[model samples]
Target: MGCFEDLSDQELITAAKGGSDTCFGELVDRHTTTAYRVARSITGSHEEAEDVVQESFLRAFKNLDRFDGSKSTFKTWLLTITRNQSINIVSSFRRRALKFFSDHEEGEPELEFASNPLSQEPLDAETQLSLKRQYHTMDKALKKLPERQRTALLLRSQESLSYDEIATVMDISVSSVESLIFRARKKIIELVER
Candidate 1:
């Protein structure tokens, strides 16, 4: 089982499909952080992101038999599931909120971005303040992006997925992914410049 750590995602999936729960667990351990990041970027709440990750993994586990490695890598497939699940949860929440408040609604709920607390070096007060301002500005700009654009940008920038892989996860063409990311970056720059 210790050797499972050396196996690729395809190997892990094969072993998991062969009734090795440990292999599945190893897959979970390897991919959970990226899953959570993808989920968090969509849902904007830690709790909601956590829920999305859990649900996505459950669905992935159940549908493992349907996964074809030739079609997509496991990470791409899993992130697609995570993205779909996050969108569903967010849509459900919006529906319920609309039902609850009809006439006097103000605007969309404020989204909370995850902080980078893993930095090892301490920063001076001025530098820290400058970084905080930049992050806040970026977050505001990101929140303004349309869902598809935001998802595309995050997958490419944060997850470091290639355009082809992003297109696969997003069910769009490589050109479409390129266009989305281009427009997203353009919009963010415009927003920040303002």
Candidate 2:
């Protein structure tokens, strides 16, 4: 694995196409965390993000032959796949939530935030409560944005993708990416100000 680890993405892809699972495994290892980050930013749930990452890699593996090196880097291609998969999953969840609400003739279901078991450092009681409140407030503001603007903002601010990269991943022009991010930031500020 060390021998293949230093290889460039294109090189790994070439080796993978030649039937080397190790090469593909290396590719997955390299991009999995970033994929999860982008997915989490979109879906806002660790479990859902993990599901999207799994499905995205599976689809990528199946369609490797169709990938064209001349078009985009492997990372960009994989992200585009991850973005689409996560968005689709989120959209499906919204539809289900809507149906559930309609059936029950009630308001939206309460969402439970899963605590991070991996966080080992203990915080003071007041600090913990303050951080939790801030996190929830920010999350609520983000959720109020339109989907395109939210996704664009997450890609730029959370994932730190360039405008061109966001454009490619979101299938829009660079100018559109800028516009979406600008509007998203403005809306988030307005929401958070209240």
Candidate 3:
């Protein structure tokens, strides 16, 4: 009743379960940007990412009672849900896109860049072209990796989640997480050098 800002995520979850819409709103505010980032990374489209975030949050809210802090922190649990939802959305999009492409021929299959390349400040035209090419090559390499490996790398490198947190979110052993990241890096290096 005093101040929601001061309370931790666990406290907010508890309050929200007890019928405090304000606490749930605070939870949404705290996680919306991060959730969007995770969704965008997998989806590579602003509109799609927004849709995934909305759906993920709705699922989380409906199942909030099932969120057990003993197993993982709220952020870890929430991000796990976001990661999974984004992947599902991407898969769905790919299926639909492929069907569309089949109906109307459109070159080879290519990975779409999730982040905006044009968002960067201007550089010399030559340098920009080179960087763009490099970016595309690296993105293609990343897209080729197995889904688990890619998710492990993103959770660690992008989200800055600890290995333990990643293991928790991924529902895998710590050693498994380490192996996925190691293999992902090795494969990416091999692909990029070519």
lDDT of each: 0.86, 0.83, 0.82
What stretches of model 2 exceed 4 Å from their correct place? 1-3, 93-134
Clashing pairs in model 3? 44-114
Give the TM-score of each candidate: 0.82, 0.77, 0.73
Q: List, residue by residue over 1-194, the lDDT tens digit for candidate 3.
A: 54368899999999988878888889999999778877766766667778888998899999999999998988998998998898887778675787677775334333233344577654666775777798778668877888788888878886789999999878899999999999999999998888
Give the per-residue lDDT digits (tens) of candidate 1, residues 1-194. Answer: 44357899999998889888889899899999899888877876677788899999999999999999999999999999999998888889674686578755344344334445697556666776777787667878898999889899988898899999999999999999999999999999898889
Residue-level lDDT of model 2, residues 1-194, one tens digit each, is 33356799999988888888888999999999889878877877777788899999999988999888888878889999999998888789685786677764333333334344588556666666777788779889988888789889987886688898899888999999999999999999999998
Q: How high is the lDDT of residue 187 in model 2? A: 93
Ranking by lDDT: 1, 2, 3
- Which regions of candidate 3 are displaced past 4 Å? 93-99, 102-138
Best candidate (score: TM-score): 1
lDDT of model number 1 = 0.86
Q: Which candidate ranks first by lDDT, i.e. highest?
A: 1
Question: Where in model 1 is the C-alpha error above 4 Å?
Answer: 1-3, 93-95, 98-132
Model 1 pairs in collision: none
Task: Assess the local accuracy of residue 156 in candidate 3 as a C-alpha lDDT between 0 and 100.
Answer: 88
